[model samples]
Target: MTIHSRAKVHRMFELVEPIATVTFSDVPNEAFLAIGMRNYWDGYFAGRAAPLGMVPAEVVHAVFYNFADGEVARHIPWVWGKTTPAEAIAVRERGSALALRQLIGELADSAELAQVADLATRAGLSAPTEGRVLYAGLQALDVPEEPVAKLWHAATPLREHRGDGHNAALVANGIGGTEAHVLMALAAGMPAEKFGRIHHLPKAQLDGVVDGLRRRGLVDAAGGFTDTGRATKSRIESLTDELAAPPYDVLTPDELDQLIAGLEPIAAAVEAADH
Candidate 1:
């Protein structure tokens, strides 16, 4: 894909992602709790990893790429013992659908949603499976017949497909999981405390990562991106976008435009409700 097309593809998926991922917010906790899971991390890891079956923590840690290993190990395997992968998948889909219905209101049942679901499913299934472990797992699942659930199911693999590519880009550039988070934090101007809390990285470890970045001229004294840091961040994102572009090739230009336009308001609704 050309740079322009790659960027467009990235933006399109960005819009589609919230349709499925809004369940990450507290709104969908009841769905997970109903399945006898402990807490958010239990559902988060279990639900996302369900398609891969009862994989161990090491596999989840490797595929997930950026989460702390201990955090992953705290859940996986243990989560599987609590609930089967099929149950986890069901609750995740249920939670996502409930969240979307609540947030989007009538839009959840609209023909536009159905159309976008179809488009996204086509795009997602068209993606190459080579080296995309997470996406491949999602691809093996059956698409749901319910409009909202179908949309979430379809958007998932597309999201994971890009995520797999993003992880590949990070690995190719010699960035470790915590290091990737550090670079992202600096690039986005996210506070160090927030990044540390989210990623479960200790202050000392975060400092070490930052100091390493500084040595490579990727971070400045003020904990912001240096010029080299900004360039490197841009390159990583560009490569991720490029790798993520192939799936969208299934859509005609007009179909792509329709998918993005249809999803924009739905994504906006999710954002509004999430806050």
Candidate 2:
């Protein structure tokens, strides 16, 4: 079956359309691992799963790993992490086969670099389940609550809680068990490092996921939410709530609440613009 049904697939391209672009680049491992994990989780275990077939597993994993690991991350380990894919008018970017850890240790003095290295290692070590195991680890961090903290709450003001319920449902019940945790993390607003810390994963994995979101134009880091961001966030909340509803409820109250918290303001903004 499709990992993401046509209807569900539209969310990334549709709701996030404003920011959506034909060629948005993926995030550095530092950024994507956070967001990529959830997407992988949802796509795999959701009602519309795209289970891997008999093809070489590395092929699919490479699609995800390479897509999420953009140019910025390549600098960390030119030969392995991001560099191997870079075609110089030649193949020289693949400098050496040095362990990723060795390069990471070189930048230990830089906090940001260190965090990013940690993200890379986590992503590298992760299984090809859209890197879910690493994602769970990254999302477990504690962070300061932002204004639109929960996706589900974002809809309450618009009386769109039912829609919110749906999104939760897709992630929790509609999706499988392992992936649900990563989806919960994104809805909760856990960024890279913090997300990694809580989940006990490398921050890079979280970065990869976020980067994936950004590449799809589903998200942006520019100060506030775009119309598309608001809409998608709202839909995610609605969907989450839908998924969380009884009979086939998947997410817990806390999970649903986080989605609402992140989406509510965006919903409010959308409604305001319409009027």
Candidate 3:
């Protein structure tokens, strides 16, 4: 793909990711709680890992690649005990569909929404499965029959495919899970404390990661990116965009434009509801 096509592919997938991720909010957490999940993490881990079956925490940790150490272990096997993978999957789909309806009103069931779902589903499935663990797991499930649920389902694999590529990029650049969080926070100008809390990394450990990055000349003493750090981050993002481009190849330029146009309003609605 040309650079423009690659950027468009990245933009299209970015637009669709919220459809799947909005489930993490309170709107869907209610459904998960009803299903016997203990809390948000239980629902998040169980729902996402459901398609992989009753896998252990190590497997989840490996595939997820960015959570704090032992974070996946704190939730995985225990979550499976409270709720089966199949149940988790069912509730998440139902919950996400409900969220879409509430967020977007009648647009959730519109023909335009269906067309976007079909196009995204096509692109998501066209992605090669090799080395894409999370995407492959999502791909193995049957598509949902509900209109909004189907859209969320279609977005899941595409999100995971890009995520898996991002993990590969991080690994290639020698960035560890905690280190990745620190770098991202620095790069985005996010507050250290807020980003660290989100990743569940303790203060001491977060500092250690930052210190390590500094030793590697990737971070300055002021906690901003060094010139080398900026270059490395740019390269990782570029590689991630390139790796994520293949799925969009199935769409013609016009089809891709249509897909983005359809998703943009829905994503905006989702964001509005989230706030």
Pick by TM-score: which candidate is best? 3
Consecutive 10-residue window with the lowest summed lDDT within model 1: 191-200
Per-candidate TM-scores read 0.94, 0.24, 0.95
Error of 1 at 180 (Å): 1.3
The C-alpha lDDT values of all candidates are 0.83, 0.30, 0.85
Clash count per candidate: 0, 70, 0
Q: lDDT by residue for model 2 over 1-275, one digit each (tens)?
A: 22233343233222222111101112212222332323322222111011122223343333232123232222222222222221210111011111111222333244443332232233222222222422222223222122111111111111222222343444543332222334444556654344432354445665565555556554577423446545665665555433322211232344333433432333333334334
How high is the lDDT of residue 182 in model 2? 43
Per-residue lDDT over 49-132 for candidate 1, one digit per residue giving the tens place of the 0 to 100 score? 999999889999999998865878999899887899998888888888877889988888889989988888898898789999
Better of 2 and 3 by TM-score: 3
lDDT winner between candidates 1 and 3: 3
Model 2 residue 202 distance off true place after TM-score fit, in angstroms: 2.3
Residues forming the 10-long window of minimal summed lDDT in candidate 2? 89-98
State how far residue 159 of model 3 sits from its true place (Å): 0.5
Runs with alpha carbons beyond 4 Å of true place in candidate 2? 1-190, 196-199, 222-226, 246-275
Instruction: Please give the TM-score that candidate 3 achieves against the real structure.
Output: 0.95
Q: Which stretches of candidate 3 lie over 4 Å from their true place?
A: 1-4, 196-200
TM-score rank, highest first? Answer: 3, 1, 2
